[model samples]
Target: MNGTWLTVLMAVPLVGAAVLAVLPRRIDGNLAKQVALGVSLVTLVLGAVLAFSFEPGGGYQFTVEVDWISAFGAHFALGLDGIGLALVLMTVILAPVVILASWNDADPVDAAVAPGRSPRWSTHSFFAWVLALEGLAIGVFAATDVFLFYVLFEATLIPIYFLIGGFGGPERAKAALKFLIYSLAGGLIMLASVVGLYVVSADSSFGPTYLLSELQQVDIATDVGRWLFLGFFIAFAIKAPMFPVHTWLPDAAAQGTPGTSVLLVSILDKIGTFGMIRFCLTLFPEASEWATPVVVVLALISIVYGALMAIGQDNIPRLIAFTSVSHFGFIVLGIFVMNSYGGSGATLYMFNHGLSTAALFLVTGYLIKRRGSAQISDFGGVEKVAPILAGILLFAGLSSLGLPGLSPFVSEFLVIVGSWQYAIWVAVIAVTGIIWAALYILLMYQRTMTGPTRPEVAGMSDLKVREIVALAPVLVLILGLGLFPKPLLDVINPAVEDTLVFVDGASVEPVATAVDDATAEEGDN
Candidate 1:
């Protein structure tokens, strides 16, 4: 059973998806939501069981391998390290919450629209796609074979495409098409790298292999490795939606339902940064180091540029989307720094960002549903009408800005500290983004929640019980991790140390005493 847990974890939602696909038309949407929620909950429980049983320093647990393509050296290999386990837990935890958040979207809001443009989707089908996506996303995080990972990577786009196109705003078709084009292009580019990896391995005494462990051992020339690294990095960069390639995200998130946005931005986008750590750095260490200077500059640009764009946005969802770009910059910075502190911070940031971003999107969805608009100007004096909702919004917004007592603050500080170890100037520039963060988050809050009640919003209601239930888990995690991050850090630090060993085998120097001495000198003067 221990050996098979990962398979069962992936199988639950997939089986549930299949069940929902064949259910009779007479089956109600509420029933479908119930079934989906149940399956996701069971998966979450299974993930928890696995987590408790997991040894903190275990490299990769519950590994199950079987031959798929003997000639190509690909296998149906699945395992979980601390990093993968954390992400798998995130996906499962968010699945049921997303379903609950999207409960109202199961029905058509405006049935009078033309048949082809109708925004409504059958609840059963909608939940099915969501469940299938949950399964695929978990598989992506857990896959140990490069080919299997790429397969899951491309497969995830299908469910999300439908989730956006079928259930989103009027421009959903265009948004969906844009997402598909960008994602497919990236995946295709990565496929070239995958093939190159196989060729390189075949040329080696190790022979051809797509298993990540074996692939790591086969060495290619510096020039070829750099090219191969770019193939993978560009794909991940596009997926990470870093800077110029990030345009599609604002559109897709603004157009899609909140739950859809949560799945896309919060969980799915993580694959990009996650891959940069797991594959790019691990398999091509020298190339990773070679590319670090340019990559770090790009990350800095994303941090500053994303914050500026977010500050100017009038649409709530789009604003949130841009903020994510900035956050991802921080994550990328930590990873590329290639030190234990930076690496660990980036991994923890992945988990924390997912929780905080989901809360923002869902809370924004609630506000939009109540106000009947997504425009910032449409929301004024929201706190007066719905204080609890406003309070949640404030907490989430503050967390986004890295308030000292929140989960994001811990990870953000770790990233800065880690980046400083690698390069102080990079850390200093990245710190400026925090100022920009405060501007966007606080300004957005002031404009939307504090002004005189807009006439249209005067009669709006507060969050319902189900909505609170959806949010409670995230809020609890936000606070719990903020106050006591040691548990998760303990799990994450060992894995990050291992990754750093694989990437550069360099040790981090202690900077705390230097900082303390500087502070003491200033105080003495």
Candidate 2:
């Protein structure tokens, strides 16, 4: 097919979305749920087909390039590396999970409240948007050209913003607006940097630009590079919702449906760290080196600070949201570590964390539906009634805690080891966050799954056959990847090695010395 597979992959979901808008949203309440599941299933299957045909350790496979905006030199370019392949696969897996998590919900609230009754329980449009989003996200991860990447990147915001604002609780509008403002601002700011980069080309030709590889080859001064790096980093930071810029996340997550929250935290949030790896590390190595220690320190703060806040949250969704801040901190730390282990771990962690966190949020959505609340206090020892649900929740919780023989365990372990080579202190500090993760996750489990059952919850129903079917694939992955990480590791290693080029060529001692200086200054502060 000569890379035509990529186009078809994207087109399937997009075409499905085009068909979706014409259909009703809900059918007898339950119908909306079924259609959403069906749409997501078809998308997932196409993604699997792409994966099954994928060649592991391949640098950039199935590339398709076509001129899109010729005057500006933009190309409709797409390709996948081993890392992109893994993430694309993970996103597909979670697409259905998000739909299932949202299954019990009726039509998008706005559709119903707009002077007309929501079409009885079909939610065909909702599935269409969700699937369309999946297709675009795959496009983002697969894009080989800078222009195409940015287009797909910005496009992701639309569906998610509508999903949250249209269907979420009363605070939905504010949450959606805040998310939009933050993300859009970040993207716009980076656009300036992108233009600036093109302007600096020797030929002063924008026509030969807007290509990722072309941009990567352009060299600028350290200061200019630093400024460019900031444009990209700030956007990813807001997306990562790390530390100071993180306030919007908890609100958005708490208000959005559980499925929406899963997409927010698992796949979308990853765009931030992925930026660091692709744009920051690859495009601005000198700037990355200069900024490494500072970022590592902030990452450490996120680890500790996010955990503390997670402990304080009464809302389950907000707790998960804060946990992302901490998790991203680890991802950042690993990126800054810039070693084989750190780089590889961070990439692998993205895959594992996506699956684990998606399961957590999606299942929690089901809990919210049954209990009519997201308050931790409202869900007491429901295992008495919903044991199947409880078991799934426990598996997800353990994954969050980095339990051994699970995906999180291997990735986090690699991150710590990779960082250990650079600064033992960074690893030591990062490890404390692990303890906090165990605390909040286990506490959530204890509160929801153990002890004497409440009257309301004791009557709660367990997983239905459809729900069980929805959850099985993820559970199998949890155990399968945990027991056999080698297959995944082998694929990731080649890409990780390629990324280590700049880092390996560097004088490690100077970098370590700079890091030590940075740490000592932080300690004094």
Candidate 3:
């Protein structure tokens, strides 16, 4: 049962999707939603069981492999390291929440009778895509073979493309096309690297292998390795949606339904940073080191630039999207810093950001559903009418801003502390983004929640039971992890230590002690 857990995790959602797709044409939207949510809940429970059963100090647990294409060395391989487990857990956790948040997003009656309605898309199909995406995302996180990973990575675009195009906002088509083009371009580039890796493997003593573990052992010359690294890194950076390639995210977030945006930003985009840690650093250590200088600069630019953009946005969904860009900068910085604190912090940041971002998106979506607007200017004094909703928004917003006693703060602090060891100036500059975060979050809160009640917002209702149920788990996690991160950190630190060893980077030192030792030696001299 333990050996098959990974397969079961990936299969359950897919099977549920199949069940939803084959259900009778007249099935209730509520029934479809219930089925989807139930499947997601089951997957979440399986994820929890996997986490508990996992051995903390072990490198990768529950690994299963069977040859799928013997000639190409591609196998149906799955495994979970501490980092992978965290991400898979996040994916499973968010699935039911997304289903609940979008419960009415695909109502058949609404589409049939609403003004200017298009009756083409079905509620069943929408739920099916959501479940399919959950399955594919699990596969992406659990895959141990590079070829298998790439396949799952690219396959994810399909369901999300439909989710954005079929069930999204007014500009859904344009946003979907942009997302597809950008993703396909990146995937194509990554495909070249994948093929190049195969070529390199064939030429080496370890011939024709795409297994990540085996590839990590095979050596390549510096010149070839650098090019291969770029091929892989560029794809990841775009998906990380870092700096220059990030323009698509705001547009996509604004156009998709909040649930769609949540999955896109929270779960799918994580593959980028996850790949950087699992593949780029582990496989091409020297190339990773060589790229650090440029990568770190871009990371700083993303941190400041994304925050500044987020601060200026009037659209709530787009604002949340830009904030993620800034947050991702911190994650990328931690990964590149190549020490235990930074690496573990970055991995943990991915998990924390997913919850925080999902909460923001879902709550804002609820607000939009009631207000019929996504613009910040259209909202004022919402707290008076929807205090519970406003409070949740404030909590999620503060978490996004890395407020103390929140999950993000711990990860953000660790990233800063770790980077300070790697380079003091980089850490110093990255710290400035925190100020920007406070500005954007507080400003958004003030304009939307604290101002005098608008004529339009006066009669708005607070969160219903369903909405509260949807958000409660994420909120608990944000607070729980913030107050005591030891459980997660215990699982993450060993993996971080192993990664640093592979990259030949140093372990974290106590910053205060290091400074004290230096000062004492200077005084003695």
**Could you tell me which residue pairs clash in candidate 1?**
none
* Candidate 3 segments exceeding 4 Å error: 108-120, 508-525
Off by over 4 Å in 2: 24-39, 108-122, 202-207, 504-525
Overall local distance difference test of candidate 1: 0.89
Worst 10 residues of 1 by lDDT: 506-515
lDDT of each: 0.89, 0.79, 0.90
Candidate 3 lDDT, 1-525, residue by residue in tens? 355988999999999999999998787778888899999999999989999998876988899988888777788889998899899999999999999988988764454343322323789889999999999999998999999999999999998999888878767889999999999999999999899899899987867888988999888788888888998999999899899999889999998888999999999999999999988998888999999999999999999999999999999999999999999999999999988768888999999999999999999999987898889999999999999999999999999999999999999998998789789999999999999999999999999999799999999999999999999999999999999988887788777777777775566443333546899999999
Better structure of 2 and 3 per TM-score? 3
lDDT of 1 at 44: 91
Give one digit per residue, the lDDT tens place, for model 1 in 476-495: 99999999887787777777
Q: Estimate each model's TM-score.
A: 0.95, 0.90, 0.95
Write down the worst ten-residue block by lDDT for model 3. 111-120
| lDDT tens digits, residue span 1-525, model 2 | 358988887777777677666655333545545655676677678777777777765678888889888766778988877778788888888888777756655453454443221322246655667877888888888887776777788999998898778767767889989999999998998788777666665354444577776766776788998998888888888888788888889999988777778788888888888778877877788888888888999989998999989988889999988888888888888888888778878888898888888888878877877786788888787988998899999999899889999889988888898779879999999999999999999898888889889887877888888777767787789889889887777777777766667553532222223446889999999
